[model samples]
Target chain A: MTEAQEKNIPDVSSDFEPKIVAFCCHYCSYAAADLAGSMRLDYPTNIKILKIPCTGKVDVLYLLRAFEDGADGVIVAGCEEGTCHFINGNIKAKKKVKYTKKILDDIGLGGDRLEMYNLSAAMGQKFADLAKEMTERIKKLGPSPVNSGA
Target chain B: MIVGEQKPIEEISKMIAEYKTVLVMGCNTCIAVCHAGGEKEVGILASALRIKNKVEGREQNIEEASMERQCEREFVDELADKIKEADCVLSLACGVGPQTIVEFYPDTIVLPGINTTFYGMPKEQGFFVEFCGGCGNCVLDMTAGICPIVRCSKSMLNGPCGGSQEGRCEVNKDIDCGWQLIHDRLKAQGKLDFMDEILPPKDWSPARHGGPRKMVREDLKIDEKPEDEIEGITKEGEK
Candidate 1:
């Protein structure tokens, strides 16, 4: 209806292909993603997987960089609670995710763009499902304001 | 040690919006341990600011520098050249740190990037509690190391007033009763005799109530000449 509103609307004709980053922990989610491929499970190609030793290694800086570098949405998948390869890495990552989410809200980036989940090595189906779910969510939110210049 | 927390990125972004070039300075001593104004925090804040720049489609020079202890003159000196190059400085240290920098570089515009909170210690990982009031005089020995000036909700020298219930202060149910802690500690150490002794009223003048206090270590002076006699030397140093 308005120029500002028009700018925020994702271009549907060209098909908005949102770029998503999934920081997968080596002990669990990474293996699950690998298994997803072997099992011929379907997940959106929009998601780009980055292997990290532990989710605890994910810093607020890394998440900020992803969005700043044109990521429409970001996911941090680590081992389930109390089951981290490193004692409490996933718990620490959960806190960092919560912290970064608040930071995203502060910067007007919409905290909903970032999400965190706890997964195990055998949950290939769950991993693929979350990837598709996040892809759909980002598609609904449209391009990040950082990339859209809105 | 002084404890502090960095102000929100949005708040800091607003403070430096008018300046084209900013120097984000950090102090690594106490604030660093608290994960606030340390070298690592300086880098984080700088990166966040850069992201804001991209989001807003604006560009500015953001420089980062950190000192071992910004409150100390020796450490603050390391930032002098960097401070001179920037249009303004965003200081991520405690209250004393920004003042120390301003005292040296009188012409520079210094903006606070953090809020200096209190004289405190880490209660545990990621949590800090204020323990001291910096009252200039301490009553720790009489109270068995528990400070009534700060730890006590009312700073009551003879407390546990009707407000204390079940070892919790009335001010906040989560806070421990300062006098209750003192009483328990004194009883445990067999030092309850302190309770029998009527303590004298404290001298408030020794604290911040006296206004702008100074500590002089005459022995540490290089030249002990009085202020009036050093006119030529001091005048030159002022510039």
Candidate 2:
């Protein structure tokens, strides 16, 4: 935990800035991100948010398109369980995320790069933390193997 | 409806590896309802192949197309233009789809993306269970509408294969014994005496043992009658 030990740890290819696409539901996760911005919370800048009517509206095609277009990681963010603006939309989104993750794994894209999260609109700090976490995780994983050589 | 599952991505990718431009075709009927192959699934699969090719450093082109029902000639004809352009076709319908395409266009290579499993009905959302064997001679009438040919583990014609334990089949406890279902249904309908009528051994000729079979309905024939049939009809008219 010392500064000397932290300094000794080799950093991942520093020049490698991951491109993450996040599909955020307008009712919750999108508003949470907005609140984080207004609250002056700091988070990674690598994530590009695409606000959808609901996480249920986040089609598997969109997630695949992000990877096809060189996104290193993808996230589907929706309202917390039982609070989806469209009842059960978040649950459906979670199932879709799981299915899409399996597709990524089948196609050798590393399912770990895709994830689903749930949060209320008031959870600005949590939203910021997720962004920072996803960025760090993706950085450790390096570039998406699908487009790495391209 | 015919139910099928998509083949593994590895196998499908390998099948199209030699081809530069592969068309991924989907059927919007049975396979679509089962979520095996549909318009949406075609796009997903095409995208997956493109990503896989990129990862493997292969420059393969994958195209997507769909048909309302791949088994019919009219629906299969819709892909005439796309079929001519692609090096090969990867049909996501049941086994019939690719075969139909192969029959219509013998010069083109048609590959099956899904494995045709069985004639089944959706038991629930996302779950399909086999229900029919298409034995040519239907025995559902005598069996209280239950198909013992397919529903029974051993296809017993007379009764349960003496392996019926309680109401479940001996092959699997989860499966309800086919004979048991028949007995229950017949008993409920006051037709229990039908079970003791001693049915005869099925004529295997009508089944698949007769080789590939075709059903022709003279009443539904749209084309001209055969020469022999026409001559017979003319003689009858003259008489």
Best by DockQ: 2
Stretches of model 2 off by over 4 angstroms after superposition: A1-11, B225-239
Report lDDT (CA) for all predictions. 0.88, 0.88
lDDT of 2 by residue, B1-239 (tens): 99999899999988888999999999999999888899988998898888888877788889999999999878988778898899999999998898878767777799989998999999898888889998888988899999998889999898877889999998999998999999999999999998998889888788799998777788887867885785465444221
* Root-mean-square deviation of candidate 2: 6.7
RMSD of each predicted structure:
2.6, 6.7
Which CAPRI category fits model 2?
Answer: medium
Which candidate comes out best when scored by TM-score?
Answer: 1
lDDT, candidate 2, equals 0.88
Q: What is the lDDT of residue B21 in candidate 1?
A: 95
Give fnat, all candidates: 0.34, 0.63
Q: What DockQ, on C-alphas, does every prediction get?
A: 0.47, 0.54
Which pairs clash in the backbone of model 1? Answer: none
Candidate 2, A57-140: lDDT as tens digits: 888888888898899999899999999889998998888889889989888777999999999999999999999999999988
